[model samples]
Target: MRPLPGLAAASVLLWGCGPAAPRMAATPVPEASATAGVSSALRPTAGASAEPEPIPAGRASPPERYDDGVDVLHYDIELALPRGSGWMQGHAALDLRLDRAVTAVDLDFSGLHIDEVTVDSGPVEWHHEDGLLSIPLGSPAEAGARHRIAVAYRGVPDDGLILGETVHGDPSAFVDNWPNRTRFWLPSVDHPSDKATARFTVHAPAEWDVIANGRAAGPPVPTPPEVPGPSVGERRTWIYETAVDHPTYTLVVGGADMVIDTVGLAACGEAPVSPRADGCVAVTTWLFPDSRAEGASSFRRAADMVDVFTDMIGPFPYEKLANVQSATRFGGMENSSAIFYSQQAIAAGRDIESTVSHEIAHQWFGDSVTEADWSELWLSEGFATYFGAVYFERVDGMESFRERLAGAARAYLTSADTLRPVIDRRGDLFDMLNRNSYQKGGWVLHMLRREVGDDAFFAAIRAYYARYRDATATTDDLRAVFEEVADRDLARFFGQWLRAPGYPVLSVSTRDLRTGLRVEIEQVQGDYAPRFHIPVDVEVTWDGRSVRATVPLEGAGGVWIVPGAPADARVTLDPDGWLLHRLHGSPPSP
Candidate 1:
């Protein structure tokens, strides 16, 4: 997800370049018994049954920190949306496997009226309050047992589902379910750790077009009278489904009168599975009619972006990709296969390619390989931020990539959030959207790439994605993969950059000696900051001659003496822009 415009403007000002792109509670369940057939990865962790520690007075705990004892496998949702009406009718059927034997199940849902609920097609008693829907199963279901539960609900949503007008004043409805907002309308596990394939059958006025996750089963079919719902005249049902498993936040539905265009196909290059047999994924754009020309032009390279990521990372994770211009609160929301961009940004013809690429990168990182815990959001946002710059590096050039990273570094250094670590533990889930998670997190990846050579770095990336493609991962999970591929332990590297706050602050001075040029470097970021291990690159130039040296600085300071050079030499630190650091004083001219 891209940051909002206000934050983007601040980023652009700091980088001195283009614009920047951009919860619920649950019930407790008994611990699961041992099962011989279940994969260990799918089973609840050892600490799953422990009660969460109470949050101190004002601090907000991470939203994804709860367990509900069930692993949802699939969701079949049917929604009834009427033109110009706030109320929506929905029927959601969830197929989930029990991790423990329990007589009751709890799901995250709120602000909607529950018409009915059935466990395996039989009526069940339920209770709803404080954002949870509790259902009594009448009998305990053993571990590994699978059950189908259906819920019929209706009401005007307070959030998650945005029912509003587009920039051009066209009536539209879009789902903004990032974090844990999916429960406002659709009920399920609603956590990133529990992923499930989904099928959406949406009923709307015939004039409206609907776009959702996965591929469309077929063209819109007239709504049959047998489908129970409020009388919305002349309605059609649009059905879409995805075989690939994804988290609830990425599941979405958008309905509006819009213009749709096909932007060619992206070659998947012998991927195990492709939308078509030819190994290609279809790329398209959906925009409000008034802004179709500009919006389509903005995403003209949508297909190319997919191809670039598919080549860099493993395969494209979804069947098809749709970039939609909608009424999303963020600058752009990476909603699995269907991405939603800010309607105003497209309508105003802003240069949003950076935002575009950022969201697209999330499909591979944030959407497919999700972060198990919200505290590990850098795994999502940081990957997208850096990979977005990498896209430009491939298509544009190295300079463009450097400039973007430089801008990001500047943004991080100047922001107040720099005081926090990338994997921050405190504050509201939304508060995690700081420079620490986005900019500094990207810098961490950048520096990691520099620490490990390109060969080892890219190899680790591919291996990590393949291992966690349809699952959750933490910073440690990533480190283990890199360690396995690079053949080295990167504990210090990740610790100083991610676990600790602030970057290396240095004060350097140079003086000419009879033997050569003398360079002194000192770490001056105060005692609170960790002493970083940095491989500093210093370049010296004099009389049309230039030489470079790498200085391994550890602890508080280090000195490097150049064996050759003149007294009148100019010095440059980190000339290649590999380090995220700050210079306290001017370097002395020899």
Candidate 2:
């Protein structure tokens, strides 16, 4: 999720509803209500005209646990998109295994009206209310038991699936299910923990071209006339399926009359054995026909980014990659195999390389190696943010990387979320998208890289990705991998950066001594800030020559003596931008 610049401050107000309340059982849908247009629960009730109060900041909370009794293995979804109306027909088949013996199964679903539900081709008693669909099993099923459940429904979605016109005023439909909004259109366990393979069969207007997750099963086929739906000229059916499982947030489908250009096959740092080689992934760009030139220019390096990250991390986790210009709410959405960028940005011809790299990096961290809990989102957003800078370092040089880190430090210092810890357990999940999770999170990784040598750092990164690929992880999971590779206790290092609310604020002064120049450092960030154990790099300059030394500053403060230094020596702190701290009084001398 690449938030548009300056959009974080407004996100809470825009998406004030936050994650939906926990699901609860409701009365069964009466047979007469099967044909209802939309669930009454979704519509605004009486006295709803008043303007709602703003959602307080730092008020969102994540679920206590992730598991929801059933583990979904696959979702076979078929949706018939209407040509003019907002309502659409949907049929979903879920193949799942029970984690524990249960008398009923609950699925996260809302807005849509259910026509029927069946378990193993038999109709079962079910209830739908408060965004949850509960199906009674009639008997307790033992753990490990597998079943295929099917749901038939239809309605106008309230969110997740955005049905509207594109920037070019052409009809378009795109799925934008970040956080936990998938329940608005699709019925399943809408949590990141229960990742599952998916097959999307979409029926849309014949003129539109559809793109979805994974490789297309085949070319577009004409919708049969016998199929039941509103008559809207010729309709085409698009089928796509993912061989690998991923979180629900990343699953998406986009449809529009657009131009798609194939950049080339991106190989994993080597020439492919053949055109269809296993080591290579095809890279393409989808854009509105009017902005073809701008889109092509912006996404010209799509394949190169794939190659760089593949070599740096492990392998590309998906079959192919598509950078699409769509009507996404975010500036850039890292949707598994297909990434969606803000249509406005591309139409205006802005240089979106940084945003593109950020989203592409998420294909590895946020998409493949997901964070199990929202509180540990730094494992996803932070990794992507830092690795985006690393991409520049590999191509542009170390100086460019240092500049990027300095910019991140500035952003963190200026952000309103400066007083919050990166792993904030409280607050609206949207608030987690602040500097604490992104800029500071990247700083944490940068500081860790400095602590551990480049060799061990990159080695641990590869190991962690290989271990958690196609799965979920937490900050501790990452710490374990780094500790194993570096062979050191990193508890203090991670705690101070991730758990602590604020960074080290230091006041430094230098004086002349008979033995050498004396440098005194004091931590004055108040009581809330942790007493950081920092390795400070001090450079003392005099008479055309300079001496550099690493001084270990712990607890409140420390004193380091530079022997044989002149009385009028000039001092500079963190000359290479290696630490995240603020200095009081005068700035470091140039």
Candidate 3:
């Protein structure tokens, strides 16, 4: 998403994208910083924050994409959770091929009271050090090897990350926002770069319901005493699982009272010709009981948006999709399989229904095909930002569309820290690149659509989804898709917007010659020192009709002569407002 341009008295325009600096979280914490309070100086500095611990030297590796020779497969996870949030025990069966020998098995589990670790039901020597639960077997895990392991542990949960105190006061915190919360919640590699399928069966209180990514195969079952576990009446125990591989960041789990609803693909009409092919995938949303009042109204219209996005992009990847309104701090978070929304959604009423649309769109960007790293968050956030606008435009009108863009642009321009870039290599999940990634990114896309034409841009987006399904991508990959569709090089355009830190300020001056017309345009650097290559549209009323011409930014300020200058001419910086940059204009001189 792109930052909004400043709405100053001036009409000149400027634009840039990315976090100004990078920041890191020392511990697991929800990245729920108030967007209104974030400042540019707060962004993380490149190379300042440490990178994720590197993968052990010679371990079995996962493929980045579908390489011809790389191992590509699916997995299924089954888990059991004991009540009182004390401990979770489960037996995971891996049906995967190992390209090379796996010396050890590493899974992440923080604050767990681990009692035993075994392989294939046999007691095995293991270590619970360095936040990793690993089994050290003398023999190597042979290539194409398959194995099953059962792990049992007990501990008081870390109580999860404390984002902030909610109105209801349920801790209102979520894990993995800034730091990986899964280490406290589940065992696995806790990073976006690591993608896997997890199926969990949690045991909790009988009165409380257990909600997770995929639909509950069935109701939670009572645990027999044969298996050591927590006491009942104190908490409930249950089981949950899924076979879908998800970006670690998208993995989310929460427990609460729910208002469940199901919908089949047939219920929704046929997909539009212009939408994505996989858009027909059926989805479901699990709202909190408090959200039931407006659940039907909000989600009932979901099929329409799903159809539109599916046709425009690709089909939904999961078996069922859901939006769960929990006691979260943010407006909502796009978790894989399920989107966790804040209970505030209940009070927002009909006008706020679009929140659902925005989260749903994330299933494709942040969930399915994730950013390889947080730096390219613009791909996920910017795409979703624009998708939300598209949905609003489809449901509302052009006026509403313009209003939405204008609001976003206004927010972007007025942001306290406007110098940050959208793609921050060193920024954390909730870094200060919001304006750059969300607002500026959106504007960059809008500009691309204008430059390449809507037909090609959307087509390229569809192609991109088809090419990188269930994988990660960078800015170059995105540019490749557009280049393939437009049959033109977009390096210069994307480079200017994605790499550059600021924009250009255009000043327009004009004079009327008795025989023709003279127009002068001056260009100055906005936020950065580099001169910007911008497309300017000029309107002139000649004869009985209006004529428009496209001009380029020249120097600090330059003049243009309209050989057959119209009788009356008016200068417009960017008639389309495609660039989320500031603009300035000089007063007319007598």
Candidate 4:
């Protein structure tokens, strides 16, 4: 994580001082019936007609291929902790993946306290707590495609997720933050980069309700007497199955006493459908009863966003998508099928449309289509950030679009912690994914829009989604699509922004003239490289009217002359703020 020149230097200065972090905004569900094209196509400048093509259901395209990967455990957790009574008990079925065999199977155990352990219905050796568990079998867990494992553990989960310790103490530490700590409470890959499908049969006190990923199969039924755990008291169960082509890390489950809303998502040709061979998919959401005062809401917009994304990228890859509102540590988190948003969002009287839309957007980028590593997080986060802005542009206008881009630029530039490269391999995962991944990531997209001339850029993005939907992708894969669509080599462009650190700073000077203006701009490359390309905007005012001209810095600095410098001068570097670079200039002339 070598620092980049510009903000990277600033980042170093505040290395241990808790670098400022950006708010990970809430992801909202999109309304139904909108077109499935990138919002860029909907721009007025594109002369886009209101009429859009419709996507058919059931003709599902295959998601990008992946290895069968592996599954270590299948948990059927039944716990009752809400009433401060009852016990936590569940049967675990574990399957181990072995490239070669000869040893034990290890399972994560930071939260659950193992009470009983058995393999093949026989007692086995095991350990508990502190995130390490080794279970031995009668024979070495052989190098086979799969091996079976089972364990039963019960304990109370801390009220919140466990984040790095703060001065207050461990219990007060932030939970459910980025890079995810909740997974430690349960067993899973624990990182977004290693997603796997899991099923849950969770039991909670009947007085308190439940909400989780996947579709709920049925109401709470009495646990069968044959089951080893106690079936005492009124208990509820939730069933969440992973969607096809969904990223493993996006899988999520949370429950509380709340009012649940169910919507039958019908397959209108205009709305997106699940990859499953069903004409229509049923969608449901649960919101806290306290927050329902806003207004009557429907899933039409969410369906439309899904439709648009499916047509542009591929069909929605999962079995189900749920946008649930709850008290979460962050603005929103893209849990595989279920998205958990802050309860304050719906309570604070905020426009929740964009929030739902953004989180759903992650279903495609961060959830379904995941970045290969944390370093390329911008590929996941940047896509979502731009998607929100594009959604805003469609609902509003170009002014809104400009405002969003400008805000991103300002936020990225002023933030002292933004010097990190947009693509980073190692560091604090949370810090790396903050402003640099979001705001600067938006700027990278803005630059893409400018470079690809809108049509090619949007077309390329749609094509990229279609190519990589519901699968893993890397930065190189993304650039390939752009190169194909724009019909040019973008290696240099990506290199300077994604790989290299820091942006260029410009020094501009000009001489007054009766006939024209003489301008000289000198560029300095901070610590990275001296060679870079930038667009410089200069405006000259005569009387009350002003004329503007733009010059591109192909090398370090250059000179240009403009006709008739009469009254005032204003100079800007990358006036549109297309790149994540900075500018320095002489005082304006009058």
Q: Write the per-residue lDDT of candidate 4 for residues 8-86, one digit (tens) a residue.
A: 3443343224322223222232222322221110001211122112122111112221122334433333333333322
lDDT of 1 by residue, 108-170 (tens): 787777777999989788888767788887878898889998887777776788877776677
Q: After superposition, how far is residue 84 of candidate 3 from its true place, in Å?
A: 7.3
RMSD per model, one decimal: 10.1, 9.6, 12.5, 14.2
For model 4, the run of ten residues with the poorest summed lDDT: 38-47
lDDT of each: 0.80, 0.79, 0.56, 0.55
TM-score ranking from best to worst? 1, 2, 3, 4
Tell me which residue pairs clash in candidate 1.
2-22, 3-22
RMSD, model 3, all Cα superposed?
A: 12.5
Clashes within 3 Å, all models in order? 2, 2, 70, 35
Q: Candidate 3 on 34-127: residue-level lDDT in tens?
A: 2331111011111112112322211222343222111323323333333322333433333334566776666655555555566655778887
List TM-score per model, in order: 0.89, 0.88, 0.75, 0.74
- Residue 544 of candidate 2: its Cα lDDT? 94
Kindly indicate the candidate among 2 and 4 with the higher TM-score: 2
Report the Cα lDDT for candidate 1.
0.80
